[model samples]
Target: MKTASRWAIHVVPGLNSFAYGRIAIQGDAAHAMTPYNGSGVNQAIEDAYVLGRMLTHPKTTMETVESALKAYDSVRRERAQGVQELSLQLGRLATFTEDLQLQPGADPIAVTAARLEAAGIWVGEGDLEDDVRKAEENFTKFIAKA
Candidate 1:
């Protein structure tokens, strides 16, 4: 990152099919990448949450599963790629290179971490399942009122 001016890299998903197994890996396990945009886990959580919803739905079918997976692939592929690209960008700008001397003020790692946390990726040590359940309960209450 310090050696160059403009940085970008596309963090690709590693064997995404790991997500569709009987006993599957969740979050970063199935698809891990840099914390460039901070949405990896948040996006993963979104991925897991959505998949859980789909699998539990009574209408789920091979066709439906395939279709949903396609949609998820479409969305997640870009997300992972984008994060990799951004991390590359930060690496270029922040890291110290042989040719250049850095002032040592900006913290790219923390910045990236903060961004990811905001996206609800890691959630500052918070409980993701609890949040999801609360959301469901809130929706149920709203529906009841309506």
Candidate 2:
């Protein structure tokens, strides 16, 4: 190659919440992460799906929208933050920079492969419907308290 360029990966710090009152953030706006786990888009989609469900619930209305958004935050914040952390861990593993937390005499390669596989399993499996249901339930409870 005549020339080569290096690009830096940027990640957003994981936030405590994704919504405030009626305002909410999704995708990279909320939890930007490294590409090692390739889960940024997926987490965004999950955010959208859950928020959409909250906004469209029959019990949701102008007066209750803020609560709905808060409900979305309650449901998605933890999960998205978790994925964000996992993505960073995967990046460390991919770069061979992670400590790997090996035991005495453990094979580094095998440990890395096992860790990668565990991360893959987490990335690959989820229940979006359950998340949406939980958000809706939270919204209902919030409105009930009002």
Q: Roughly what TM-score does model 1 have, to 2 decimal places?
A: 0.41
Candidate models: Cα lDDT each: 0.49, 0.88
Give lDDT tens digits, candidate 1, residues 2-120.
Answer: 58776664445556454352334446665566654465667576667745754564544654444444434434444444454555454444453212233479565566545444444
Over the stretch 1-146, how does candidate 2's per-residue lDDT look in tens digits? Answer: 77768778788897878888779999999998888788899899988989888888888889999899999998899888889899889888888999877889999989999999998898778788888888888888989997
Candidate 1 Cα RMSD (Å): 10.5
Q: Best by lDDT, which number?
A: 2
Candidate 1 shows a clash count of 8
Off by over 4 Å in 2: 1-4
Which clashing pairs does model 1 show?
1-91, 1-92, 2-95, 7-89, 9-84, 9-85, 38-116, 42-121
